[model samples]
Target: MRGIAAAGAYVPRFRLPAEELASAWGTSHASGIRRKAVPAVDEDALTMAVEAAERALSSDAVDRDELTLTAVATTTPPAEEGELLPRLVRALALPKSVETATVGGHTAAGAEALSRALDAEGPALVVVADCPEGDPAEGDHPLGAGAAAFVVDDDPSAPVTGTAWHTEETPGVRFRERGGEEVDSLGVTTYQRNAVREAVTDAVSSLPVDPADVDAAAVHQPDGRFPYRATADLPVSNEAVSAGTVVDRIGDAGAATVPLGLLAALDDADAALDGDAESDANAESDTDAESDADDAGDVENEPNGAGPSIAAFFGGGTAVAVAVEGGLAVEGIADLDGGATIDYVSYLRERGYVVDGEVAGGGAHVSLPNWRRSLDQRYRLVAGVCPECGSVSFPPEGACQSCRSRVEFTEFEAPRTGTVRALTVIGQGGAPPEFAELQQRDGAYAVAIVELDADAGRVRLPAQITDADPGDVAVGDEVRATVRRIYEQEGVPRYGVKFEPTA
Candidate 1:
């Protein structure tokens, strides 16, 4: 049973409800159309891919060097060709000879990239990304941008038992004009559901295990309806669907949604294990709590054979379904699961995050006491009206470029809420030696600007999004800001801003 070894997920912070677009454009799509990821000016598909891949490697049990191949699946790129992999590989410090495969031309190329990984002569990193150009007048103007990645390993948590492909270069769900034009949507609803149902239904039915016995399912994160539509056509129930539905909340992330959704599910399962371990111990006299998770390492070598069977599915519209049975040998994967259990107290000590006060209950997201953590909504945001124009900036910068005048800015807590005004999928290039000099771990990260709701069109700058799928994001959806590390621009550890859904 070549089952799952580990999984990771990611999502952009900003969201704009499709309804908002519908209201603005006075069209049906504006009401509930698809959304895309919103990358900050500093980000690209390469950065977003790196972010997703890092999470996959970090949260899953895996190794860095074990990734011998990198298959980058994207629809857009700064350059059509030219060692793009090197830019990312250099950042993550991956192997020098790692084989690189770039698959573009279509959004569904994500699944194609995964297929490449499976066929790889060796272990590989599979990255899928999408960040359509943001065109205001176009219907897809609010395309959400995002990416998801996975380090291939025959691990137990996220095993890849057997993979099959069903592809057609024929006419797809939507097409565009000659060049740089808005997409032409035809039977959009019918197309989405039909494609998803055909692929998933065929794959599941042909597999050995029955749908009733499958504990979980991770399909494309295009919409909340995808799960219901795909599953209702099969034997699975509503409960069987996982909560990767960040689209309404965050706007659709182009490439990272499916992988992000899978990672989210894996995180959920790991958290559950932690809770059960704690609850069981608390009820007893003392937690015996092993006091040290490392101590049980040698013990874990012996098979417990007592966990549920999990399924993960990713790729563009109507991608193939994958099923991994229990029991498989994946080496690099176990290391990632080790990360999910890291104690907040220990993590802080290791990273040396700012200690403002007593951090007892909350994890790193919390502040010591009155002060905030390195990454927090309050710290990442501050309201300051332009000295010259009187226009406000959510993050409150020193100089007001608007009026070019320094006003006696009164301090006001910035609103954490916002929507995705625009986004793009891009790559990181030309970095100073400090950030660029170091061995790069991953290539991409998801970044976005959140349009503050209270401030009308004001933005919170950039923020890292979590627990979301790029496809699940939509324009006009409600969102809130959070402080997080987008990635290290240089060894200096660049502080960043990101958004997530209010719900």
Candidate 2:
């Protein structure tokens, strides 16, 4: 009965149109791909993973306290040897005793992580995030960024019935050397096509269910064309494969491609079932009154009749196929909305390929020890409440701000939704050295002092505003806290809460 209880996905809010890239390099647009999702200056695999995982956990399909394991899969981790799992655990507020593992080194790692989660004895959270980059002039494929997460447990929703794996050494199709920033490909069309067909056919052939019986299929999508091309000789129909094709919109998201496609297919299957039930109800209403009870019962049972779905993931000389049946789709699992389109110059500047000059220096530097100590306050909005005076203090100075009491204070988590109390716009040269890069990439930005309600008292926090223009934000606006990159210092990203307009 173990399967995906809930699923979630994240696509960055900035999109670089295919024409933008084409115009930048004086080349024609890649066929079928319109645009690609681009991460903001502050966004990377870790932040995007946290965003997706939070949405999945919030679906209420699995209890947070019952989660015993968390596995993250990513080909582009923020730091090579850094402690990524720890940061994820802290951000999610998971128990310190929870077992954590990181999986990577190939694009198919997401499917591998999902397989392990379904096999685990207890509930597990699996997250796959990647921001694949390559020399735009070298390959026809457009590299993009995205993330997907799933909660796997014995809840019986979207039950995974069968799994298979196939692997061989097909060198040079796509690879990234150690300490390299871009992915390289051999551009061998015949070799790549043959490898995909052989691996996918072999894995699907080993499954217990007939390939023709699969209602939907999500295949590895390095590009919009490859996925459809790979399924030409398979038993599955083109319609079934098209149900999960997403690369045409968001481009190739590396480890996240297959998982995101699966989420989309699950949503489509659930929607189709809903439509069928509606049709049955409408037909039943036209029947005689005597058959109403029987017709209603049949309609209630219709959602459970959905057939099995297949998802095949292939990359780095490996392919995995999984069969899933009968599940409730989490709402809005594949919606990628509220995005802003940017031109080529902005895209290059944000990607750090068009640095105008040396990075401005002289911003005050905070020690790593101090930053570590404030993680709870910075990431989770944790405040301290004075037991004696009913006053809340941010960053918990160990002394009550109102009563001046020197006793220990109880920790409290502040509400994420708040109202802006004050605001300021930092335009161009007004930005500090730490924020100079951000200001340069993104035009003028706003900083706000937000007021949050606590158990005993209100807490006010000063934070940078995002996802909206500075001129558009004003005092008294409703806002919500979101984790984003604050700045980079000492070759490490500093993550903290940023306010964004709720509307």
Candidate 3:
């Protein structure tokens, strides 16, 4: 039951142009970036994870008795918020018998999730995908919409082979401390590099398996360049690089980067199970796992019909690398062939009526965040707290927290941004079906209690940070929410809203 049986990738339907992103950043990768998949309108970490999981399952058969669900939630970099694993896991169509869990606290938690999945009983299905926060650093602006997945099972056609990994723990370089009103990024390059070197080296060295045996790698990162630098000394071959390196194109994907790296590898090598396996069994695999040779891509069952084996690894910044290996072939369930321009204004107001920046006499004024010039639209969120008891809800609801009041409406979008009311990291999340990897590099996706800047007695709510580090999150920071993928079904745009970092 253990070979990479099938694979799938999910790129959100929305695609931001390189020009737009570059314009916002004051500099850009003219060619554009391939940001990780993000759910649309109504999609969330759970739904995005499932979209990728469904794609992974579409290509293969997963035993209802054997499905084990695990996940990690991430946000865009600059816009700090929090990860919502609990909310997400429930969205999956997984059977009542299946076991499900949430992993968070740090970006690297994904690695830990990988490790757990690897140890699951029987043939297991592992899916990894992301919706990294968007603004922390605007890393997701260029191509920040989509999801990817791999199913790890015990099947033979395609299986995963895990090797060595280690921990590289450091306190400073990158931290997302959420205080009452804001998030602080005390990230120091020198410190990050020093720690990255230590953990990556330890993981690689511990493997003892020839660096040659290890195919190209995916690092826990938003940008693609750093991984190359970290593995410089390792025997990583160039042939195994993923397409749309973020460093050059999309930017950083936060918690989703590593999975995105794996997705990039899978996409670049569409049929990694068949054609790529044949053309580059040993060496090319180290560099390139497979290729998208034709439509209806299929890999012939091996002599035993067992598929090619893969070794998806997750290395977190905590200097910890967890390895998990299993089987399942997964790929995009929808077309990832197009890119779209984000219209935050239309996008936002279209979602009902979003207004977060300022207010006027009768209506709220929507002053798009600096990041929105490229990504048009803000979310039109309604305030739905219990009318009698006093509770806060994003979308206005008929029921109440205290008195279930159907009337007493004061609907509005997030007020004047907000701050981190509370936060936690995410690990293990939306994954490709049949994903097999030990543990991700130590990483954590953040989830935060967002308090609106509006005057509703410090409007507070929960949100997922779009594009920054969990450790870097803090309370009391200003932030604005926007419409992001709340979830999706068969590639349709399911919309909702989330928050991003704001200056």
Candidate 4:
């Protein structure tokens, strides 16, 4: 009965229109796609995973103390050689004793992570994140970025009814070299179509329920057109498949595609069931006795028809099928509407493909040991409260800033949502060498001293303002903190909290 107790997703606020991409390369837009989600310059697979994981955990379906394992799947990790699970674990504030695992190098890794979580001994969190890159000139412009997370446990409300998997050697469909950044394809349309069809058919056929009876189907989509063509022969209807399709707006999110699509289907099913329940309640409350009797009889005869059942299909070189019986929609799923659109050159700059000249040896550098010691303050916004004066000091300075108290200060976690107390705009060429690249990618940004209300007192901390223009931000604006890449030092991406205007 292990199933998804809760689920969450993250789609970046920045989008690149397909027409803009086509204009840059002077080609037709990728077939059946309007726009693709693009991660901000400070975002990557790890950061996006953190965003999704936090949303999933906020549901409180699985308590943090009860979580025993954390598994992450991603094709585009921040670094190939380092351990990413620790960072995720720290960001989520999970127990230090929790087990961790990283899965990647293939697009099917997301399904593998979910399977492991279902089979594990205790409750586990499965996170899938990817920022896929493809050369536009090579006809691979649909690759995009996104993340999704699920909490798996023995929850019967959303039971996992059946599961199956299929794998085969299908080379040259899509792959990357050992040290390559871009995913390469051989344009083997016939070969790719055959592989997707065979894998999906075999996997779906193994499910316990009849395929035609499935209320919804979520299939891996490398593009908008593939899912429909692959599921054409299946017993499921086109409307059922279309309920889970998301690539038309978000593009190909690699490991995150199927999971994101499944979430969408589950949300739709939950909404429908809720609407039906409300209607039934209203009919019973009305003055009509015959309608009540009819509804009662229908419920008695259809005891098994509580909620929509969903079929999920994952495919890369490997394919997995999972049947889900019921669902409870997770809150805070990223809204895909109204993202800021950027032109092609700005997109290139954000992706690091086109950088203005590099400046060497400028910004302040912190040693690994120092950075490690301050993770709690940076990631969780932990502050220190003065025992005598009750003043809060951010970064937990040993002494009280108000009364100069020598006594040990109490630790406190500052609120993430706050008000801007002061602000300044840093124009181009005025940034330190460390921020030179960021300044180049995003011209003229704002810095704000935000005041966060803590239990003991107010704490003011200086941080860079993101997702807003320098000219637009003001002293009274409301903002929220989110983890993002600050800069890279010694081959590592440093992460810190940045403030964005509250939606």
Candidate 5:
């Protein structure tokens, strides 16, 4: 049985309330969404996908050797061409031999990617990440940013029982120019209603066996209410649909919606099976468990005995559906809170809709050395462990920085977390071109010197502060390193680690 062995999601730790948008524009868009997730100034589809993949791997001890295929789905890809999957594969520290592919250009591709993983004979990871773009006044209300990841295996965490899909060339419902922003049809509302309803109905009916066995259902939600409307006449019930409907909080995270909704349904199914009376606490516990497992390298195996769960996805002219059974417990996997709230102006700055000017700072124009050293500097955060002095070096070198010993050293995953030993906030006039947008969003931004504290040893590292207000940050604040886009050089995004305050 192939299905989701492990599931994880990334909801950017920042929210832009609809009210904030309304306040900014002086006109409300008439929507049920209170707020939507917003990626940090440094975050994009690639970094968010990496985080979600790490979380999924934490729930299941997927050996690197077992993973044969990797699929990534996103409408908002960080880069246009060479290789999207390799970046994620390296970020996950997977072996170089792993085969990979990119499925994109539509939201339905996410489900298609997951379905491909389910069909694979060996272990596979399917990831969907999107940071959607839209016009602030009109298109922004329904677009939210998030990512979801799933690991598929012969014996999955969530086993699959049945599946179906349907596709047709229905052009112009939604379209985007090459290397351009997406634009929906003026008739988008009506077009989506009919397309989603028809596609979901047909896909469900095509399942070989009876489809009514579904106990829970997850359908594509463009907004808070679309799933309810689309599945009204389907075999599933309101209660079943309610379990997976999360757009009320996160908004429509294109390419991530179906996977995230499915995760919510699985969590609900798991809670019901356990008769979990304290759902809120259990969810929090589950989140902690996953995070702890990832931090400590001791992932737990918690199984589920839930009944069938039906997931459906519909995008421009395409739809995919599947019925899964067994191993579907995913509490806390999708829980996201403790996020910093940003105003509408900050949201626009972060999304790059309002840029101050061309960012000046970037990686080395020559990329060979950086590319070769990625495993050490970017992926593993590898540092030297000197045998003689027992001191760790941030960048492993010929000699130990602490004792000046010329002894050989072993390399391992360095502590990517630490405390801010020194901090300074640069005002807009003093900010570099790379950070001018951030300074413009907020009057000032902080730069920190962090002292790393890990099992290996301590090392001081210079970093930028994110996801918090300048005045709120202090010298002793605890923070964790997160991968983020430093800047783009020659049309390529340069990624590095940045620190954010811990909640």
Candidate 6:
């Protein structure tokens, strides 16, 4: 009876076109992809997961304390040593007692995380994200960056019936050399394609319902064509499986692919239900009008429920098939439009491959005690509210600034959407060493002072601008807060919220 209560996805705002890659490398074939989403210089797998989790939590309105477990699955983890899930937990403001785990090094880890969430005793959160490394010459197997998250509970809107899985200890199929950035792609396509197809076939045969009766279907997409190719021999048709097919556009998101495809399938199901409801409403309205006029009309209301949806998630050596019923409504998670395109040089710089093969100055070296002490203020942006004057200070200082009240201050809620009040352009020679790569890749970025009017009082914050042209941003522009990578110090990636102009 466990299923998805809510779902959400995150796609980066920058895209790299295949045509541009071809021009840069002088090779026409760039994985036959049109374009792929590119994370900003300040974006990564963890931040994208945070974005997706925020959307999922917003749609469900579940109390943070009620979530008993949090799972994050990613092949490209933020750091090699430190725990990743705790950072996500702190950022989302979940209860410290919530159990956390991280699954990695395989594309199928996402399915594993979701399966665990489904088996939990209470509400659980599963997040999948990846930023794979590709060959510089080949453009990283045409990699794209993104994340997806889902909330799972017994009384879920989309209930999962069961899962059928197949796995083996297949080694050397896909791997990376030690201390290498590029993944070796030797003989990977043939082995992976056949292995996935065989495993998926076996999985489908175990389902109770006939494959032909499935309302919608999705498969793990390594390339744009892999899904269609793998599912061709199955009983389902291409149209029925359209929701899970996204590799042609967004490229391969590694562990994030299956969950994103699941979101798409859920969205398709939601749209169909909406259409049916709207049609039924119209029919009833017409019937009412006819009854009022003493004429004749007939109207029928259909029962509300979700049909069966089949999904297959592939890891390097494993695959899982899931059948879900009573699917939930999807927020706008699949919209991949409106992104800025940069050239190959800019892409290289953005990915931190420029500047003598190192990111500038390695940024700030934040100590452990300082980092742990400011978790609430740094991650969740929690402020301190003075009980006497009700004024909020972002750092949650010891004493209230407004009334100098010596009493314990109330913790203010996180910042909401705000507008740019004052701004300045940081051109070349102005960016800090930590952001010099950003300046080199994207010229003349804006640093703004943003203002928000809350119930307590007016709040002002200084932040950097992303996903916009410096010339286009103005004082009155409205913006939303998003988690982004600040910098890496001592091999640790620091993340914080930055404001982006809302489109």
After superposition, the stretches of candidate 3 with alpha carbons farther than 4 Å from their true spots are 1-6, 28-39, 68-90, 134-145, 179-184, 242-251, 266-316, 319-329, 333-337, 343-503
Q: Count the backbone clashes (under 3 Å) in each candidate.
A: 77, 1, 204, 0, 2, 2
* Candidate 2 clashing pairs, residues 3+ apart or interchain: 158-327
lDDT of all predictions: 0.49, 0.79, 0.45, 0.77, 0.72, 0.73
TM accuracy, model 5: 0.87
User: For model 1, how does the per-residue alpha-carbon lDDT over 1-503 read when each residue is reduced to its tens digit?
Assistant: 33335443444433344444555567633322344334543355665665566556664366767777888887665345554566556545477788888886655666677767766654678777656553454545335556667666553445665554454333445554555534344546776667667766776666666666554455554554565676666776444454323343334454445544444333333334454443442333221232134125432122212222333343434456665443323222232222112222322222222233332222223223423232233333556676567777554555664665656665455655677765542234422232221112222333456677664335456544443444455666567654333433212233334566655
RMSD of each: 18.3, 5.2, 16.1, 5.3, 6.2, 6.1
lDDT of 3 by residue, 163-229 (tens): 4556444665444445321212344766666667667766756653455544335554534455655
Better of 1 and 3 by lDDT: 1
Tens digit per residue, CA lDDT, model 2, 211-311: 77665688988887787777777888665676567777777889998888777666533435455543443442332332233335532111222356788
lDDT of 5 at 276: 44
Model 1 poorest 10 in a row by lDDT = 299-308
Per-candidate TM-scores read 0.54, 0.91, 0.56, 0.92, 0.87, 0.89
Model 2: residues with Cα > 4 Å off, grouped in runs: 268-305, 331-334, 453-456
Stretch of 10 with least lDDT, candidate 6: 295-304
Summarize candidate 5's per-residue lDDT along 1-503 as a digit string, tens digits.
77777777788887887788888888755266667888876788999998888777776447756788889999888766755787788778887888787898888888878877876778898889997777667777668878888888877646677778888766666666787775454555776687778888888777654545454567888777787778866766565565566666677788887777777666533334444423432343253343233225421112221246678888878877887764454534544433567788878877767776555665235475665575456656778899998989877877789899887778887776789999998876787765555566545778899887778788777778877777899999999887777655556676767788885
C-alpha lDDT (0 to 100) for residue 321 of candidate 3: 38
Residue 392 miss distance in model 3 (angstroms): 39
* Candidate 6 lDDT, 1-503, residue by residue in tens: 78888887888877888887788788733454577777877888888989888888887446668999999999888776676888899889898899887998788888899988988989899999887878777637467877888898877878888898888656665666766655555556777677778877777667765777665576877676777767767887565466456555666788887677777666533335455543532353242332223212311111222346778887776878888875565554644443678787878877766644335574456786887787776667677787788788766767777777775668876665789999999998787777776677666789998875556666677888887888899999998887777666666777777788986
lDDT (C-alpha) at residue 107 in model 5:
82
TM-score of 1: 0.54
